[model samples]
Target chain A: MTTTERRLRTAFEDAARTIEPGSLAPLTIPSRRRRGTWTVPVAVAAALAMVLVGATLIGDRMRGGPPPAQALAAGGPQHILAVRAGRAVVEDVTGHRLFEVPRAEGRYRAVAGTAREFFLAVQTTEDTYSFYRVTLGADGAPSRPRKLPGPLFRTQTGFGKPENLAASPDGSKLAVVGTVDGHAQVDVIDVRTGAHRIWRTPEGGAITSATWSQDNRTLGFLWGPKAADLRLLDTRGDGAELEDARVLRGSSIRSRAPGFGLINVFVFNPDGRTLTAQVQGTKTGDHDDTGYVLLPLSASTGEPAGRPVRLPSDSFFVKTDTTGRHLLQIIDGRPGRVEDGRFSWISRAADYDDAAW
Target chain B: MTLFREHQLSLTRTALMIVGDRATAEDVVQDAFAETHRRIGRLTDHDRMLPYVRAAVVNRCRTVLRRRALALRVGRVHEPPVWSAESAAMLGEDRREVFLALRRLPRRQREALVLRYYLDVDDAEIAEVMGISRSTVRSTIARALAALGRQLGENA
Candidate 1:
């Protein structure tokens, strides 16, 4: 080695010796605790139903006029399905609970939905997790929950720790990042047919999150623990080979410095040419240190077309509404609408884990 | 649990190199251990636990750095790394300049140098821990060394 290089290495080694890790406190492992199963009370369900109907009427009267003609033309006001305290509650943009899951059997981990359907990941047993799809009736009431056909996921690391699950905009397909046969696999299931296609990571790195493009033909997901890269897998082709999936070479959302940043949420714009991501900037502090940005990508090359437009900081969760016309974000536990490069709060006191507009 | 007992100290020291503070480094390692414990049942192979925990530590340290960056951007006062008298005496003046310059480098370059010199890991292992390609690791280490050489006024 060169003299200078050797000197540099010696200096680093000397500095590293100053840390005495043995003096740190020992790690404590809590006993394995089981989450209690939840069942919605019959009386509570009836009361909630009454309150929902009453709220609809009261909300209409508060508007000082009839419901918007466009809303009537489109059937009704769009609903946001949010899971709070193990119960999935459907609410409108004004934060009124429309209805809730009846006889909720398990703790709801994560939720994804469309105007017509709601998909929830519920832990039925200590280790068993399953997805349930509840169709919304014309009156905005949810139908009897039906278990979606797929391999059961484990709640070993909470509901959505190492793996993330997302449903297509139309609610026909569900994409999940989970383990299959001792490997980290991405499974795309045709919710109706119960048939699935799986893509396993060759290097054994875990897939953190998955989201379907608006067109429902492509699935975008984040891979790895540190310095996780945003990868795209084309689901249009037959699921015959792993080669069908390719990492977007230059589309890393964070700094290459491992663990400096993370892309928490990403979705394709309605046009399918642009991508919006809730990216945690490479800053060290609290969990709320992240931002939202818009990066236009080349449809053909999968590369970003231009520089990203940074939204507001601390906007951790983002999703587009059903019509894909408006962008919604959760900032400081409240819902906000993003328009004209600004975020305006929509609801006053809403604390939700996930919301689908 | 055994993995924590075996590698916790080494991991903390490695984190200390990246985060440049003993308390944050310890906190980072503790968080990583807690997370690893929570997800331990999902691990397919027990042998991979150390690497997994190591990567988690690095990622947690990055989170700390990220928060620090945001605080600085908003003009918030943050505590600088506290160097003990014993540490200062051991580091001396020339090594202290090098350490300060190391902290000033971009996160990626600093990580590359730490992994290459302090941990003495090769490109392949570094790539796995950093979640990058081996080719990227090679280039990153080379660039980092060149930058360090320039900062130290040494011919590369």
Candidate 2:
């Protein structure tokens, strides 16, 4: 059966076998939500039902239990964002907003790069970098963000293009990814030490994104144009391809602007084989301008290691990053799909990239 | 209005997965359904109510978590779903691994992910539900994905 047909059957079967007229509450008069939701709502309601309960419960325990003593009290989580004031909003049917923050001062966009803990966001006026942390409550009131200890001491390779700040879970290290000199680069700063390093895309252009391995031993990201390649930086191991770069297997679609292409490396699956992103019509971060695409990574040689998967074309792709490689990724295991039976996309569209959630 | 009941058993499970406590997940789902009923009309689409409700429960839980952070002033978040590793295996492959990894993310990242992928909801919807602007949704998702990708690529 076609994927669509199977999904339809699954939806119908799920609906028939499990959906009680009463269980559903009256269906909302269809309105702006489809536009608001990507494609039709996810087809696997029955399966997700179990996940729904488990997720909420787990989330609750994490919330109520005494604070985890494991976390060091000295340094906290550091985050950066490409914050923009009210461009779009997340709300439910009656217009009661779920995300209840101030009509923000600005929106924060995440700059994804190797597992640099914090983004070295320095105002143009200063070359030094500091850490910023803002705590957001479910009620949406944000605690006044405070700067953490130490400061960055180098110019980033992203050149501040996708300027972003992030802190390691332990809050000991911070990485800042952004465009510098029109190129995307990531800078790593020792939260304990003033020491830092500037990682520039050797090929040129903005760095689309970057990530660090579980051990934080290797860092990888996308950079350059048609010849754009995946760059891996190893802090302690030899992780780079023999050629020093692994080119993504996909067409290079130019951005709406002539001579510009807006393809980014979305996420390197835990196995580090699959990538998800949108080849957009423009460079700016607007869903109006983009759709999701899957890019498969193979050995530096162009061998078909596995089939490249495409997200349901109707589905809109968001710009969020999952946590450490050892971190969990939401997956859909329908046989031959994203490996480990997991798909990493989560919640509606995540805000401000992943600097914060 | 009783959609939570339709899937209450499962919702109970989902909550447990997130909170790591069966009893608490049941309470959360029950409350979530009640909240969903209160917010029913406002939720807009019938199709998305399940995820909406799920997101709501998860959001509520995350709310509790933020307070925990403040109580400590600085520390950690992210505990595995309640399922034992073996029992967790009973879940669909995608849900188990990803959710496990997701919990590893900062609370905000985990919340952003649940709303983004689990519900297959859009950024605007997430922004509305999370009460943040769409731009922030975009930023969080981007960073979250990058974080996941990096962890997967280099470590795997």
Local distance difference test, per candidate? 0.63, 0.41
lDDT of 2 by residue, A1-357 (tens): 212122222322232222233443322322333343533455467568879988988998989843321211222222222222322222221222444323322333322223322232333223443344444443434455444455433343312223234444344556555545434456666656656666554333334445444444444555433234555555443332223334544324432221233344444444445444433222112111223334333424322344334343212222233431221111111001122223333233332222222
Runs in model 2 lying further than 4 Å from the true structure:
A1-129, A134-144, A152-172, A182-184, A201-203, A224-226, A237-263, A271-292, A295-356, B1-156
Note the chain A TM-score of all models in turn: 0.66, 0.43
Candidate 2 chain A: worst-modelled 10 consecutive residues by lDDT: A328-337
Ten-residue segment with the worst summed lDDT in candidate 1 chain B? B147-156
- Winner by lDDT: 1
Q: Estimate the Cα RMSD of every predicted model relative to the unseen true structure.
A: 17.2, 20.6
How many clashes in each candidate?
10, 151
Give stretches of model 1 more than 4 Å off: A1-77, A137-139, A155-163, A179-182, A224-227, A236-244, A251-262, A282-296, A303-316, A331-333, A348-350, B1-19, B22-156
- Sorted into a CAPRI-style docking class, model 1 comes out as incorrect
Candidate 2 yields a Cα-based lDDT of 0.41
The per-model DockQ list reads: 0.11, 0.03
